[model samples]
Target: MKLIIAGATGFVAQELIRQSLRHPDIKSVVALARRPVAAPPGAGADGSKLKSVVVKDYDDYPEEVRRELAGADACIWTVAITPSKSKRLPFEEVTRVCQTSTLAALEALHEAGVGRPFRFLYMSGTAAERDQSKTPSWMPEYSLLRGETENRVLAFAAAHSTPSASAPPDFSACVAKAGLITHSYASSLFALGLRLAMGVPSVRLEEVAAAMLQQVTTAHGFEKEPLQNEDLVRIGRRALGEGRA
Candidate 1:
């Protein structure tokens, strides 16, 4: 399968790319990023199995870049900063970059003749929900905006399908709502404490990527809720073993 990994240089995106290279079912990977990715050590300068599509900015991708998306079976969109880091840029900018750019890219795909059955897996946060209106005051705006984006993307996915001509427009989308904890020192420590004290859940990065990929490749109905970490672990393990995601 031909896959596209958006935000290829991101910590999570990098892991997904590395893993995708090892999957026998994956034929080629298109790594879309603002800057070119350095080939993995031992891989050629051209990145042999990977194609890096560099854009000046996520908000403005050129037509040629859009064309590169043709024939892609799936897209793993892993862009967007955490709420805490979003403050580094204006909230309006963050919202546009995170939400608007996503819409633009999908539209680009359609205009570039990408068939509709294409699966889009968005990396969403756990608290991104229609009912999450009362998150901490400090980040209410960001939370609500993300929630809105999630709703919009889900709606769009439900209306489209791949190889547009062969199937009615019925694109599929899944949101991998990762946990507060990640496979990092700080996050791991916090997850350990939370598990022992507050029963908070955490997941491995590999598991999260695995589950997200499965959601896209399979024909399961659209998922309406944020997938919890434990759910991801289960689905991920199943997916890694070539079972239904």
Candidate 2:
């Protein structure tokens, strides 16, 4: 299946691209980012299956960008600003980066003519609060923003996924609420202290990517709207054991 990896230059996005290149089921990978992306070494020999598409503005999809997205069966969106990054930027910029861009991409991808049951998996954080009425103790503003985005995204796809006079919506969306995706250093004292201080759960990077890959590639599409951190860890561990990338 053709897969699109948005925010291709990110740490998580890069790993996802590396895994996608080696995945037997993924026929082609479209890497979308502000700058050109290069596949990881020793993967995707000659990098023939990977194509890098640069987009200057996520708010607007240019003709070339839209053309590149055509026929894609699924997309893994990893384009949100992290909590730490949000602090350094203005709230307006953060919202545009973390929320507005996502909505735009959803609309653009839907228009890309991806056939029935097209999967769009968003990489969200556990801290994101879906209920706007309640204030989140951690990063309340940011969490609410992300939560709002999640609800909007689900609503957009829900409208299409539900049956209508024309047909069932061709689009579907899933939010993977991962928490503190880390590397080997997760066991380190600093990392441990950080996790304890923030009260955030942690999972390995591989696990997050593996579970996402599985959900998007499954023949029947994802089973639910939100897949929590534990679910991802479980699915990822199994996939890694089976050498499934």
Candidate 3:
């Protein structure tokens, strides 16, 4: 399968790129980044499967860029400014990076004319509010904005859903609502405490990447959208086990 990974320099994207190279089913991986992406550690043997596409801006995809993205089977969109990171920039800039860029990429891909049943896995957060009307006290505005973005993605999926069995499914999208991501064993204790005390979810960075790769590589369609932390954990664990086989 041919896969496209946006924001390839990010932590999760790097993991996805690494795993895609190792996966026997994945034939090619397109790493879309603002700058050239280096091969992940241990990728020396499988470097031929990976290609890096550098773009000047996330929002703009010229014809040359589109040509590289053409015929992709799936895309994992990891581009976004996190809430904590958003505080450093103006709200407008944050919205542009977090939301506008997503829509732009979708447009570019559509224009590029990727294959039918194109799967798009968006990297969202657990705190994202689906109901934009009900504003929570904690980072309400930002959460709502993200929720709206998620809704837009879902709507896109709905519009592209196959109308009949005879017709091919044009596009499919799923959102991975990941929780607090921790990398070290020392942080596992804190993650567990947070999950038990506050009912918040946490997942390892590898788990998220594994789950996403599994989703795209499957021959069957995704059964669920907006995969929660537990869902990710389960899928990821299964994926990791499969990788070892």
Candidate 4:
């Protein structure tokens, strides 16, 4: 499979890229980043790895960047400023960058002439609840905005799958809402306790990457709602041949 990974520098995205290289079925990867993404110096020992595309702006990618998108089978979109980072910027800028950038990337895919069933995996957050109308007061804007984007992506997928006479070629999208990522051993310990006590899944980064790849390669159809962390863990483990926990 040929794949495109947006936000290639992200923690989870990098793991996906690394694992994809090891999968015999994956033929090529286009790692798109705001800056150049370099292959590990000795990465070829396993298999052919990623082709990096560096652009100054995700929304205004250059023609050369567009050219690299040809013949792509799947796109894993992992772009988003974290809530902490969003707090530093004006909320308007955060929304525009997060929402508009997604549209631009989808437009680029359409313009590149990608075929039907071209999978697009959106890395969203578990906090984007289904009830956008009843958003919490503390961070209502972020929740609603992200939730709204999820709806838009689902709509886009529906429209693309059944293009009109003049509509551009497009693809399907599935949103994966990953839970709180614990980067440290302590965090992992906490996550394990949560999993055992509440049965709420908190994904390991590798697990999330695995699930994203699974959805990309053979998503039966677009899912209108987000795939929560527990869903990710279950789906990912199945893909990895570990079965369910």
**TM-score of every candidate:** 0.83, 0.93, 0.94, 0.85
Off by over 4 Å in 3: 166-168
Report the lDDT tens digits of candidate 4 across residue range 10-110: 88777777777776667888999988786543344344457998878788867788889978888999999888889899988898778889888888887
What lDDT score goes with residue 155 in model 1? 76
What global local distance difference test value does model 1 have? 0.74
Candidates, ranked, TM-score:
3, 2, 4, 1
On TM-score, the leading prediction is 3
Question: Could you give candidate 1's per-residue lDDT for residues 1-245 as a string of tens digits?
Answer: 78899989987788777777666567788999998985544333234679899988776868789888888888889888788888888988888877998887777766666544677778877656555545644367787777788887777766554445555345677677777647678888888897898665778777787777666655553344457677787887877677331
lDDT of 3 by residue, 1-245 (tens): 88999999998898888888888888889999999997898655578989899999899999999999999999999999988888888999989988898989988998898877799999999989989779877788888888899999878767866676764456989899999887888778888999899888898888888998998878786748879889999999988987621
lDDT scores for all predictions?
A: 0.74, 0.86, 0.87, 0.77
Q: Who is ahead in TM-score, 2 or 4? A: 2
Instruction: Give RMSD (Å) of candidate 1 vs. truth.
Output: 3.8
- Worst ten-residue run, lDDT, model 1? 38-47
